[model samples]
Every structure is written in structure tokens, then in C-alpha cells.
Target: MNDDGHPTAWERGVLERLLRDTLIEQRRARRWRIFSRLLTVILVLAVLGLLSTDVTVPQVTSRHTALVQLNGIIAPGTDADADLVIESLRAAYDNTHVAGVVLRIDSPGGSPVQAGRINDEIQRLRKLHPNVPLHAVIDDICASGGYYVAVAAERIYADKASVVGSIGVLMNGFGFVEALDKLGVERRLLTAGAHKGFLDPFSPQHPEDVAHARALLASIHGQFIEVVKQGRGERLKDDPRLFSGLVWTGAQGIELGLVDALGDADSVAREVFKADKLVDYTVQPAYFEKLIRSAGGEAASALVKSLSTTLRWR
Candidate 1:
């Protein structure tokens, strides 16, 4: 159309460029479709995997020591929570070929209620399966409520260096009255009950509230002492410092009658139970939950590493 009926050079060049652009665009579209389909398949598989993580009892053909790990803080919603431990203990007892059971504990302890629940469940399971003896193996530190859970076991083992015992209850918190004053912050609290605002951090510490708190702690401590005495019986020594919130090394614990002997989970499985092969009966969290928790822990670690930034921001 450029003054002649023949095809012009410029018009031919333009056609070639347009055709190349269209081809490239088509290639891109095809790649994107493939990527979308791949993503969809991955998402479906992940969903299925997460949904199928429920615990199921498996028949064992050989005798083994069933291991149920109690790690981290003994709080609700944690790995060492009562529910998971109870389920693991039940599962360990349910399996027919289990020669013995081991509750491996590595915790500084938290939530006395959670620990008590686990202790009670352990006792119940042991009573039902008396033949399958269960032993508590302390890994690193097992104090406070951790000992509460361990006391229920038929026998407790630990490494020579492992920390054991803190048979006491504590309800600790900060008194921020001075901090609020420095920040020019006013605390306005309302409650229907007379002691509803007990141990309020922003208010001045009341002698009555302090006395009440001490009494509550003493009651829980007394309960803890009773449980220990019932479980340990004559194994525990008559020393007053035994239940004074003082931790002792496993070797020292044996001397104090807090630990049975110096041995790890492996030794207990091999020597005490005579079963070298160990089977894990601990109920694990779902994959998705684990990922989420791992991510949260990493974020928390990062935040802690940037302590100055966190303080400044607040």
C-alpha cells in the first residue's frame, strides 16, 4: 500500500516483529498455565497430608520398648502437654508386644495442672498394664512439674549430669507499679469481688494479697509433696531441702533418693527392659502445625535477637 501494489520492506519487517511478539506471548501463557496447575497439585497433596496425620495404633510383630517423649514446657497446647502425653501413654499401653514403656522427659516444667494430668494418666495406664513396666528417663532438666510427672513412673532414670527435682509451686509475676508511675500511666481496674484485683501488677502490693498468694502456693506445694511422697515412698530422703525448690544433679539425686540410678533412655531400654529396639509411641503434631510452630519460633528468636529494636519500638 506504500505507493505500489508489491509488499514494502518496512511493512514486511513490521509483520515479522508482530509475529515474533505473538509467539513469545503464547509461550509465556503456556508456562503460566503449567505453573498454576503444578501449584494446585501441590496444594491438594499438602491438604491431604495434613488431614491424614491422625494417630493410629499399629500391631507390632516383635517386643520393644515404647518411647513417649515429653519435651519443652509442660503447658497446655505444647508438645509436652497432658493430652499428647496421655494419648502416647495410652497408645504405649495398648500395643500388645510392648515389653516396657519409657517416658523420656526434657523440660524445665510449666503448668502444674498439665503435669498433674500427665502424672495421673501415667498412673492409670501403669495400673492397667502392670506387666509392661514404665520408666521415666530424664534427658536434660526435669524440675518442678516435670518431676511431678516422673514420680508416677515405676522407676526414674537419668544421666549423671541431668538436673532433677524442684518439688515446689510458684506463681511469679512482675510488680509494675513503679514502671507505670514513671511512664505517667494510670491503672483503672474494676471488679465485683473484693479480691478480684488480687496481685494486680499496676497497683501497690497488698499484704493480704501477698498472704493469700503464699497460702495458695503452699497448698499447691503441699499437694506436690504428697504426690512425691506417695510415688517415691521410702525412696525419697527425709532431708528438708529435698522439696525446697532446689535442683540437684542426677548423681546427687540418687544420693538424695530423688533418682533411681544413672542411666539414659538407651541404657534403660537395653539393660532394664532387655529390649534394645525402641518404638516411638509419642503423638506428634500435624505437619502443618509443626511448620507453623517452627515459623513462629524462628520469628520469636529473630525478635529476641533484636532486643534493642523491640525495646525501642515498645
Candidate 2:
């Protein structure tokens, strides 16, 4: 016992040994935790590396070029976008091992601007690669924008039951003045110009606004018709309704001269391109991109739900 009534030197030795042993254990535990974290990081890095690098390079033969898929809606930043598709097409065209390309299209159509851009790209690529033939294989449906894209190809092929051809423009919306009145809701809109709110659904529609919109649509529709005519050449049948925003079956499409032949992807690949091997260059979103997108969607949904609940309660 010391002067303060504490442990003696011998007693302090045992106490220090116990404390030292506990400290050592704690240090070992921390080191193990750090090692485990480092191992996890290494494993994740390995996986990411493996996924980022393309393991299999597409084998191109002299028989034909790479086959590409153009499925889903054709829009900017989408799988069927013109810029992305064109990049792949350029790759196929530039590939010395490939002889030609077959574009497999399956879509209900989207964005006239996007389709037009794609059409121009395809035509330009074809001009550049005059010898390498590019053919279109229409799957389920290739209407409107889809048909527009197919027109740029050397020939359009589809099954007898496939839906095709809606070479027209459409703008859809609704007027809700009556509904707002029934709900006793007031719509307050302020605009800088007289025609700024011309198409406001809450207010009564102006005849001039309707006329203006119609004119705009008509102009777009005319452009679409001209493109189709240029693509089909003199093969287009005497059907005025072809550009009336009316879709048709594959057989009907052929009759209207919208499609050149009737066949599926495999059939076109085998008969037209003469190559059975298919290579898809459609760029998919990266894992991190998908994660970020999913997280963003979740956050947006949660915010919307919170807002909806608050509005309902109020």
C-alpha cells in the first residue's frame, strides 16, 4: 500500500500486465478489422475490373458483318438512339473482317427527331460503305419512327404478322377546364406574351392556337411523308392513307411498299447478310450508373409519396 492507500509495486505489476494484455487484444482486434476491410475492397476491385473489361471480342468473318439489335423506343439517351447506334454501325462498317450488317428492329416508334437523325446516319453510313450492305429485320412492330429508321436501310424485311408503317406525326393531350370547374379549383396563370399560354388546358382553347398547332403537325407530317417517298422510291403504292397515321400488318405493309420482304431476324441474317453469328453493340448502363439511377428514382418516389400524403391530409 502506498501513501495514498493504493496498490504496492508488486500489485501494480499484475494490474499493468492485465491492462497491457487488454490493450494488446484491442490492437489485434482493430488490425483484424482493418485487414477484413482491405480484403473486401480488394475483392470488389477485382469484380469491377472483370466486369469493366470485355472478355469476348466479337468474331467477324468474311461471310458477313456484325448483327445489331435496335429493339425498344428510339430516343436520345436510349438503347436505340441514333448516335449510339451509328457508332456501332461505324464499327461494323470499319471492321475489315465484316462484310455487311443486319439491323434488327422491333419497336412501336418514338421521337421523330431521333428517328430522323438515325435515318440520316444510316444513309450516310451506307454511302460511306457502298459495298457493305445494311439490311433491316422488323420484329413485332416497326411503326412510325421505327419505319422511318428502316427506310434508310437497303431493304426492310418483316414477318407476315408484324405491325409496320405509321408514317405520321401525333401530339396528344387533354383539356381539363370542365374537370377543374367541377372540382371548384381555380387555375391562375400569368404569361409574358399573348400566345405564351395559348394551349393552357385550364383555360378555354383558342381557335388560333388550335389552327397553329394543326399547321405545325401538318408540316411535320409532310416532312415524314417526303422521307418515306424518297426511301421507297417509285415502289410506293397508290395509297393516300399510308401517311394518315394508320399502322398496318406486315403483309399490308408489303402491299403498300413500306417493306421489301417478309422474314424474321434469323431469316434475314441467313438469307440477306449470309452470316449466322450475331454481335450486339448496344451500350448498356454501367453498374454505378444503374445504382445511381435506381437510387434517384427511389428518392423521387419517396418525395412524391410524402407530398401526396400531405396534400391529401390538407
Candidate 3:
């Protein structure tokens, strides 16, 4: 009877150990399932909330300085993109309680086209919202396309040591001609237009293309100068180097008439605009984006945006 029916002590111990491990694993799996369910519910609720939420210009009860910040490179997809900036500006302008609009600028400049659109919008908004004055306050730097946008404001203010001007237009591209030749690589770009492929980096540089590019740059430069002249009018000094694509400190800019005075946002709001209360009117991303961003999907969003080509104006 003992040989046929009795179980070994080691075998029973092994069975108990296996039972414990299995229970532990089951508990772990249960916890994971519960966590996943809770996470899913929370996400669904969040989605519902976002769907119900409206993205609109917030109304202010009191007269305050509406701060529209041009914070980064003014390109198509950036925060300082013309579309976003113009949206912010339009909201600021439309606000009944907005005493004055302050465009807080800090950039090394980006797309000239984007900047020009923003500048033009500012001018148009000025005419529409004549009661509310607009002023540009330079923080760290406002150069090139940044300055172009700034000029649209009625008055430009900056800190004494702040960088103020680069009033220039530039198109930058890399040249791989020498590297291609060294690597024995042949350039094979076919274009329908005669001059379409002239700027191809892998191809040999031609004098005619160089001359044409310079001419194009000069024409854009002339447009930039005309804008500055119109904006500054009699305030600008009679210095030939003013539009020579040279950056200047705010103090130097004041002397050259690039910046009107030395002041910060606080000073501009309190002393200049006479409104101590500052209200930010920057166009921010919707709640869905912020939620996705918090849950580590910002890279996914950026990747989706990067499917299109990007052209930079340096």
C-alpha cells in the first residue's frame, strides 16, 4: 500500500512551491489586467472631455496688456509660425478688454515668408483694432525675419543689452559637389525648368547660378529695407550700415533707430501702456495634444508632422 499510494515528501514540497509561484503569477496578471482596464477607462473619459471642450479665445473682464509671444524660430511648423502668431494676434486684437497688445519677440529668425505674413497681419489688425495699440518688446533676440515682424508694431522696445537687429534675408543650402566627386558619385537630377536644378548641391557650381542667386537675395534685401523704411519712417538714422545684415545691441539699435527705447515687458506694460496686468494671448496646442504629450506621444505627433519637407530661411 505504501509503495503504490503514498506520495513522496519532496514531491509534495515541489507541488506547494509550484502552487505558490502560480498564484503569484496569476495575481500579477490580474493586477495588470485591472491596471489596463483602468487606464483604458481614463483615456476614454479624457477623449470625451476633449471632445466636449471648445478651443476659443478666452474672454477677459478687465483691461489688460495682451501678450502675444513670438518665442521660437518663425517657421511654418514652429510656435512662432505665421498662422499661429496671427491667430494669437487676432484674438488679442478682438478682445474688448485688451488695453494694448504687446508682441514679445525672442528669435534668431526663420522663414521670411512666414514673418512677412505675420508682419502684414499686424498692419491689417492695426487698422481694424485702432483703439488698441500694438508694441513689440524684444527679449533675448529679434533678428532678420524677427525684426521684420517687429517693425509692424507701432513702437519697438528692448532691453539695453538685448540683441535687436539683423534686417536681412538669406537662403541657406549645403554643397556636396566636392564630396560627391571624391566618392565618385554622379549627380542625376532631372528638372523640366531650365534653372530648376541650378541650386543642386551635388552638381558643379556655375557662375551664372551664383550671380542669379545673389540677384534674388538682393531683391529680397531691397524689399526688407523698404519695409524698415516705411515702419521707422523719420525715426531711423541716416546710417548706410543699418540694413547691411548686421546685428546690433538694443543700445546700439536705439542710436541707429532700430529700437525706439530701452525697456522690459514689465516696464512697457506698466509705464508705457499703463496696464500693469499682463494676460497671455499666445495660441497654445489643444488639450488632446497636451494629453498625448504627457503620455509620451509627442514624438509620434512630431513624426507625423515631419512627413512633409521643411525649408529653412537662415
In model 2, the Cα lDDT at residue 47 comes to 66
Which scores higher on TM-score, 1 or 2?
1
| TM-score of model 2 (CA atoms) | 0.75
The residue ranges of model 1 lying beyond 4 angstroms of the native Cα positions read 1-58, 297-314
The regions of model 2 sitting more than 4 angstroms off are 1-62, 287-314
Q: Which model is ahead, 2 or 3, in terms of TM-score?
A: 3
- Candidate 3 per-residue lDDT, tens place, 154-190, comes to 9999999899777776755667779888999887888
Worst ten in a row by lDDT for model 2: 305-314
lDDT of 2 by residue, 1-314 (tens): 89999999999999999999999999999999999999999999976864442323455555554777787767654567666676767767767766567888898787788888888988998898788888888889988788888988888888999999877777655578899999999999999998998777678889998898879788888888888888889888998888888888889888989988888767776766677656664445345534654668557755754433111000
Ranking by TM-score: 1, 3, 2
TM-score of each: 0.78, 0.75, 0.76
Q: Write the per-residue lDDT of candidate 1 for residues 202-303, one digit (tens) a residue.
A: 688889988988887888888889999999999888899988889999999999999999898889999999998888888876777667668796577556
Clashes of 1: 0
